[model samples]
Target chain A: MPQEASPHIVRSYEGELRRLREMIARMGGLAERQVADSAQALIRRDTDLAAEVVRRDAELDQMEREVEQFCVRLLALRQPMAADLRLIIAAMKISSDLERIGDYARNGAKRAIVVAQQSLISSLNGFERMSELVQENLRSAIDALVEEDAEKADEVWRSDEPIDGIYNGIFRELLTFMMEDPRNITAATHLLFIAKNMERIGDHATNIAERVHFVVRGEQVTADRPKGDDSASAVAGAPR
Target chain B: MPQEASPHIVRSYEGELRRLREMIARMGGLAERQVADSAQALIRRDTDLAAEVVRRDAELDQMEREVEQFCVRLLALRQPMAADLRLIIAAMKISSDLERIGDYARNGAKRAIVVAQQSLISSLNGFERMSELVQENLRSAIDALVEEDAEKADEVWRSDEPIDGIYNGIFRELLTFMMEDPRNITAATHLLFIAKNMERIGDHATNIAERVHFVVRGEQVTADRPKGDDSASAVAGAPR
Candidate 1:
């Protein structure tokens, strides 16, 4: 039988867990900022800020590698059981989600730079609202993970309907712009992709929320997530 | 100190590892078929096949859950060290990648249904070719994981450039189509997204290959994988 761990070992293990949470918190913070900055860059047509968002994506990639290395080390050395093991696994998965979130922001920023070059065709209000909602959900999801609050995570999970609703509106409006004038095609296409990227960012936030819920409750979220994005099968053509 | 494992425990542990590989192989086969079928459905304008692809995505999701639960159980019971531990971690990560690939296929299938309703605007030959390449890469990546062949994984990692190359061509071609006629706008837009979905599925295949490389070599593919997708920064205006 294994002997009881000394107080020193126990304290050190606790510190390591605290450090893991801090790492995730820091990573989540960077990802959230990336999403916000990318949207601001698009709405403001600030290519400089967009370039910054693109440049900062490398940091998130590096952070994910670091988090995975740290988790693997914890698993090997600490041999954590029960909740700690679950938390470590959750950290690895969340880091992957956050990295993907960063990639979407970066891709949006890249397109934002391209969009800045084209004449504006449609109101960007929908993009702004969509971005804000996605950012809020991402922030709440991260907070839920750090705080170990399943209810907060559940709220974020249930709240993605509004983001999808905004995305649907944007999809139709952008298509209309393209149909009205061919000149709008380039700008509208990039904007449509940016809007889609924002919607995907929201989905990643929901994925993070689900992971957090699992960590806190030690069970999967059984309820079917409410989905509102119906633009997938949408069809539109030039007015007859 | 723990006693040396008996023959039966040793044999059972090895059997468990074999079972894990088989599970991954099965899941990977299903994902590859989904990609192929979705592409074929679009090219053939077969809405029935597209709907079937959409319906089958749930199986990949369930498989991902099963893979994770099994990996967690192994981690807890086996406390596997070194290569065994890395393999389990890789399995979890790869399953997530596969699940996302399934989602892309399903999304593409949904868009294909809409595209089928509109008159075909351009040759879907590019789509068929792109889908074939992506399916090949996904298959090779999974085979690398099961066979523990780092070189095969590297080949898949390095081969994604052509998929992105084709996607860039499709992106510009669709924009040109939209600019040519207002009626083509709707179908072209949906085709643009389907092409993008295929590109993303290819990217996920590269991700799986990278994970396999890590599992085999115990280190990441350090040198940057070549990237050819420049559509994010592409800009095109209506021909003056």
Candidate 2:
């Protein structure tokens, strides 16, 4: 009799895990769209679309909160071990990153709204290309996660380096525009925020890839891209 | 026969959990010192010091990996329940945030190195103050986490608003400097990066606060003031 009851509890635990997976996928899809729309609004200078992007970020945040709550509750109640516990925790971390990505998109969209109104906004200079890359990277990272595909995750991680180069190019171009004339400052600042948002989206994509690696092999793959040095002590003697 | 050994396994699992706690505390201390040093580097423009900061970042990243691995191993072996599972997951997340915070400091110090060559580059307003606030918030948030104090976590959350405001102020100032003169672009770019890094540190601190709330109360807390609601429709539109 006791054995039967314990198995029933385990089965219910499995049910909760399934539900959690569904919630994460839902959140991922919405987050991906927010990035796409935010980019489209910027290129098109459609304030209405940008405003919409801003509004949707709140729901992403709320959904993320809900999913995290569900996962933690399941862990507390069921006491999943090994792969199951890892799955729930990975979901929590992944959702948090996605929510932040949504926030970035909304922030970019807000800037797009302001820049769209200006009379002298400069050319975005391959920004649309960069935005598309970011969107694709994000979409694929989530796909890799759900499928537990390590190759796809690695691809997503590699995608971030190129995205960073593009961001640097964009940054320099914007700096030049602002230097050329004062009228460019406002729109340029907004554009810069959008670019930063795109770069951050890339970062989140990398985070998802790392999570995918963790889920698949039960080992951390973040060690692949090694940071150069500590650079911690360099702060004290530098000019403030 | 089995009854005699059950208590031993339980006891060993508890010991492993305690060890995790100690590791988390050590990681927290390392991260807090990084923040402090980054601020000092910003104030001093010390290139050597900045280099050290960058060096320390890798160590923190390594520590993060180790912490994550330990958490995984524990989860796999112990199948802990309720508060114990919550604690482990929180530790995993908190260490990730700590590593990222270390990154922010390294990035900041790198910028300080670039700015070190320039003559007295601190003209950008609000950065020094933002740095101090971020550093203080990080210290307090880590303290709260180590001590398991919810009220401290709340204070960290509330403090993020002011940090955001200061970051905005720094952004605007840097934009003005770049707008005013073409020659300042390179150095100002470094300064802008420094500002972004500080803002990121603030974000990391907020993340810790959220984890603390999740660990202690099994509920989610808003890490910052809520933005626009339009994010709702956007979030709702995605396929679940």
Candidate 3:
């Protein structure tokens, strides 16, 4: 009887691992939607959508807690080794990165509400493009996790430079607006932060991809992460 | 003979736990110094020190990886149960938070270098005070982890409000400067991000405290975290 039950136990453990991946995939889906809606709220100046995005962030926080608790329980009960162990650890870390992505989205939504009240500073086309890239990366990263595809994860990791490139352009353009007219300062400043938030969200997506790569390949991505955001060291001349 | 060997094995495991705590404490000390030196660089307009801070951040990233590797080894070797497991997990989580804190400090340092090249906008007294409080909180949180004092962690958790309050003040003041003259926009904007970095560092400290609290008590902090950053929704009128 004990011998017969052993097979069932092994199968159930495998099922639990599958369930864990599903949970993360679900959480990732919600986070991606939050990012999309927050960006939409900004581009369309929809305060209601922004407000909804803010209110919805609590769900991501709660999902993170659930993921953490589930991972801890698995660690305790299964004492999983090798790949299983790495996958569980990766799940915990990925949940954290996703939670932070949700936070950046929520912050952007709040700033959007403020930006909507001011006159348009310039075309928000850059913001739209930036967010679209971020969401695509976020989606691809999560898909790589669920599919256990390290190549896809590496693609997401390598693709973040373009998002940073867009952010730099937005940063310089906003600074030009501020210098062109003081009236643009308030809106431009808030928009700068929102753009920063999107760039950060992209970074988190890259972090998730790196973790997935580690889980599948049992090694860190050896290449230095490419970064294009030079805004930190940027200096603008005074308005003449 | 087997019993005799078992005693030695248990003692060695105990030593490893002690070593883990020491590792985290040392990492925390380094992170605190980075925060302090970054703020000092900003306040004194010391470009060399700011460059040094930027250079030193790689060490924190390496430390976080070491902590994670150690925890994974322990999990695989000892299969630590209950409190031991919790402590190891908390160390992993706290190291990630500390790594993030180090990144914020490094980014602030980079911006400080740029700010140093520009004319002074306003007194950096607020930046000094904010960094001091953040360092204090960071130190207390690490101490709480080492001493297993949940009350100390709780105290650090409650004290983040003041840091946020300082950040909000700096945000408005920077906006006012940008409106007064476009010449101040570049300096003021960098200073604003530096202040925001300090606030974020403080939040990471609080996150560390919360993790420590959970390790000690085996439950989440149930109270809603107090937040004072209203700058997210702030709006400033055109300059007179």
Candidate 4:
């Protein structure tokens, strides 16, 4: 077994770590809310809510840095082992996922900023559905982390397929809207970005779920998900 | 200064790490080319090339896993130090970025799958140009890592704004196309996913650039990009 830090120190660190975990979870919760709110704002053309989501992101940024520093310091000072290593790594990965999710929310807000001004798209149907799926995934992924539930992590992994299907559906539908009316182009374009952003948020949630699985099971569950593989030809100067 | 690992081990490990880095670089290179190829496939409607791009992604996924395993073994046995720690972490981040870039390529290909069947959307005029910018950012981000060029990293960071602008322009144009002609929706939808894929690729490139900066500078540059602020929320939990 790897040599761990002082027991008492580790104990205290555990307490601190729990707090850190909670903070990260809280931050994730806030980001999730932001994404939902932003998506809704886009649907309803609510400028105030969109701007609020944008402003709140700065604070999230500050908190993210702080969390990373804490994780690094814990690594340096405590030399956390095994499950601890997994947790720290999970924190890092989940944080990255959360941050990306925040970007999606903010992007949704920005699109809301632009699209809200003009005529709203009549069918925000798939967009709404996609947003809800992402939110559910985000919630479950974090809950899996909190509970250390490998089962829950697996559930999140399986859920990604349908999310993609929805995104694909939205992609086609939005195209129909954009293709039909030049006047509808501006609003439709913003809506498309919003849909893609929501899809990505679901993807990130899936990523976090992967991390959560790794943390709990000590095996990579992400292998079951879609991963990029066009890299083998890279070594021998093979034609890309 | 941090203590070094066993010299003989370090030397061999260094060689392995170098090889690993190169492999990842090559992977990055491949993923970059695939992005370019898929974009070209979309423009040219080469369905066969798009299919080939999809088939090749499996190899990239395998390489990514290989790099991760190699890094873990080195860390476990070699117990790397500061620059080395940074290097390993950087490799991890780079590999992840490379893998995601590959995903974008597949994404592009998938869109091409649809676009290949339909008549080309006339308004997707600047797509190739926008894709080149995204591809350039991917190339430079990898170069920044290879050369340890902080300035190049910064350059990559700055370059993303224009890609965003192009993406915005594309979104609007596509919307306009759909609005003008209902017949254009099918091709237009495929083109939009392609655009979204390209934009996602650009974001992943920016992620690599950010990771390179972190490796070289040891400072988190997460706050600098003001686009959507996605990374801060999911992982920002405070240590309780």
Candidate 5:
């Protein structure tokens, strides 16, 4: 009779896996909203919105912890093998990456509050553009992972180059602004950091995409990732 | 006879676990050297040393891959339960943290190569002091993990506040320097980034210590980890 009652108990395992996936998707959505809101707060100089972004980061952090515990429980209770194990592991890694992206967005929001007080810079639009691109990549990466669409993940990976390009432009422009006038240094430095933070968010997106690829393909994505951050070289004026 | 095998065969399982521990220790050593060497290169303006640090990052990257694969194989083959399961998971997480530490060091070294060309600032010594503290913490954290010393890991976690204090000092000092003179902006900006990088390295050390605590104690470390980087509020000039 116990063996015959297996169908009812077996459904719970599938339900647990589905619940884990849904939790990750919820986290991704929160992180993406934080990214978009923080950028808007920066561009609009809305200190209130920026403060809200800072407060929302804790939710993602909490979600990441919950996801980690869930994965561990599944591994211990179900003893997942092969593809199932890989899926659980990838979910854990992806949650961490999403949590980090939320942190970056919070950092940007914090910086935005600072820069808002200063006389606004004309070139601040770059932050908006950069954040928008990274947000798109992050959303796509999560979608790819959830759908198991490695091709879409690959697309997200390829789109990172443009984000780097925007970042490099912002870096050079900020450096030039700082060099031209002493007054620009403080705000320019903050802007540079905000730009750098967005770039890092892009990197995290690529990292998530790679995890998706690994889970689906059972192989590492080995292409040399492109980076366009040549600001140091430009600042040093060193010949490569 | 096969079931009642000699002690030699039984020891192999323990040996595999030891090998994994040794691999992590080796990776930690390499990351420590990278952190120390990169900081020295930055402070001393040693281009050759900075270049060397940059080159050595690839080794840590390779080690992370090896450690990951080894952990995956262990999980699949041994099907470790409870404590052993937690240790393997912790090992995977710790290796990734170490690899990120290696990246931060490499970024610092790369910036150092550029900053070397500019006039040196006396306040830059703060970075040296900060890097030393993080290196010590990282070493202790790895030692804790390898030896399963939860007490030592707690010590490392507690040590992070002082590291943050040093970082905050560096941050405020750099800001004042930049505000005082335009000439200080370029080098000060670079120094600010290096200091931030080291601060992040310290945070990663705390993260490792937390993981070690988890593996040994079977419970998450619940203390409010300290942070002293108040640059954002100072820059924002917001009333607390």
Candidate 6:
């Protein structure tokens, strides 16, 4: 097991690690909320909520900057080794991923603004379902990071397959909808991009999971990443 | 000006920085080749080449690991200050971006394999153009890193507008083709994703540019990012 720091101090090596964890936890909370709110905004066509998501992304970005500076200072002053070093590095990477998750959420919200201006489609359901899974994976990934639980991280890694499956279904369905009417093309395409963003968010969550596994295990995760992306397997012209 | 290492030794701090730069350069070269080859495979419908791009992604992933390890080692050993520190962190970020670009290329190749089995679209010329631009920007971004030329990086950052414009144009053209014929949806959709990937590659390049600026200036690039994404501005409902 790795040596984890106590969360109750602020001066020594352990205190720094504790602060790092806290910053990451805070960033993760903000990121998770962004994902949830962005999805909710898209589903309800709540442009105001989407705008709020866009505006709040700056907070995550600021948190990322702070985490980076803190990690650098810790690395510089503490010159930690072994698990502590790994933990610090993991903190940097996880913060980057969470910041990116924020960007994806912001991008989704931006698309939501455009999407809301268009006529509605029933297919936002796919987005909602996909975001739910992504949000769950993201929360779990962050929890794993905080708890340093490789098993929880592994579970999140494995859970990406279902999200990919849902994405593929959404991909084909969106194309069909676009083909049915050009009017649906704009909204459908926006939805496609939103789904793609969620898919990427899921990928980043898995990335965090892998990082968590690495920090705890002191080695890279060697298992093949599970993939269920069948959306591009066959051309529409090819025999199924 | 920041102190640069003579690329001749390994036992000194500057030598470590030089080695880090060399690794990043090599990784950047591999990533660039992957992008070029993936686009080539798509254009020629050469599944073998596409497969090669997918296979070669492992090299970039391995390179990313090496770079990460090297950076962490340098940090733990040297505790570099100012430019050196920024450069190391930038290397980590750049490698991650390069790895992601490689993944996008591999994804494009995978889609190209399926696209090969289907009917071809002349609109692929747009993809060719977009990839060329992205490759150019990526090359310039890396060069900016090597030369520590923030001006060049800012230029590359500005250069993304044309790429986005091309992407938007392709988005519309592909949507038009798909709207005209349901049979075109599958291939056009794949092309759309490829275009989006290229757009994202361009974004990554700009991200590198910003990092370059940051590393050289010791501060974040404060200017607003230049964005000309017309993809969401108007629906396909507008007159061609």
**Residue A201, candidate 6: how far off, in angstroms?**
0.6
**DockQ (Cα-based) for each candidate:** 0.82, 0.24, 0.82, 0.20, 0.51, 0.51
Error of 4 at B130 (Å): 2.6
Q: Give the per-residue lDDT digits (tens) of candidate 2, residues A93-184.
A: 89988998998898888778777776655667568888888888888877877777878988887767777777766776676676676667
Candidate 3 per-residue lDDT over residues A89-143, each given as its tens digit: 9999999999999999999999999899999989999999999999999999999
Candidate 2: regions farther than 4 A off: A1-16, A226-240, B1-14, B121-125, B222-240
Reference-based TM-score of each model: 0.97, 0.85, 0.97, 0.84, 0.95, 0.92
lDDT for predicted candidate 6 compared with the true structure? 0.87
Residue by residue across B214-233, what tens digits does model 2's lDDT show? 77786777445532122112
List the candidate 3 regions with Cα displacement exceeding 4 Å.
A1-5, A238-240, B1-5, B237-240
Per-residue CA lDDT of model 3 for B10-41, tens digit only, reads 99999999999999999999999999999999
In model 6, which regions exceed 4 Å deviation? A1-11, A237-240, B1-11
lDDT of 5 by residue, B20-128 (tens): 9999999999999999999999878899999999999999999988988898888777778899889888888899899989989999898899889888765566787
Task: Give the alpha carbon lDDT tens digit for every residue of A47-150 in model 4.
Answer: 89999998888767666767776766666566666787668756865776688788779877977887767676577777788788888988998898889898
Writing each residue's lDDT as its tens digit, candidate 1 over A1-240 gives: 998869999999999999999999999999999999999999999999999999999999999999999998998898888899999999999999999999999999999998999998988999999999999999999999889999999999999999999998899888989999999999999999999999999999999999999999999999998999988887774331
TM-score, model 6 to reference: 0.92
Give the clashing residue pairs of candidate 6, or none: none
The collision pairs in model 3 are none
CA-only RMSD, every prediction: 2.0, 6.5, 2.0, 8.3, 2.5, 4.7
Candidate 1 wrongly placed segments (more than 4 Å) = A1-4, A237-240, B1-4, B237-240
Prediction 5 global C-alpha lDDT: 0.85
Interface C-alpha RMSD after superposing true interface residues, each candidate, one decimal? 0.8, 9.1, 0.7, 11.9, 2.3, 2.3
Residue A151 displacement in candidate 4 (angstroms): 1.2
True contacts kept of each: 0.73, 0.26, 0.69, 0.26, 0.40, 0.55
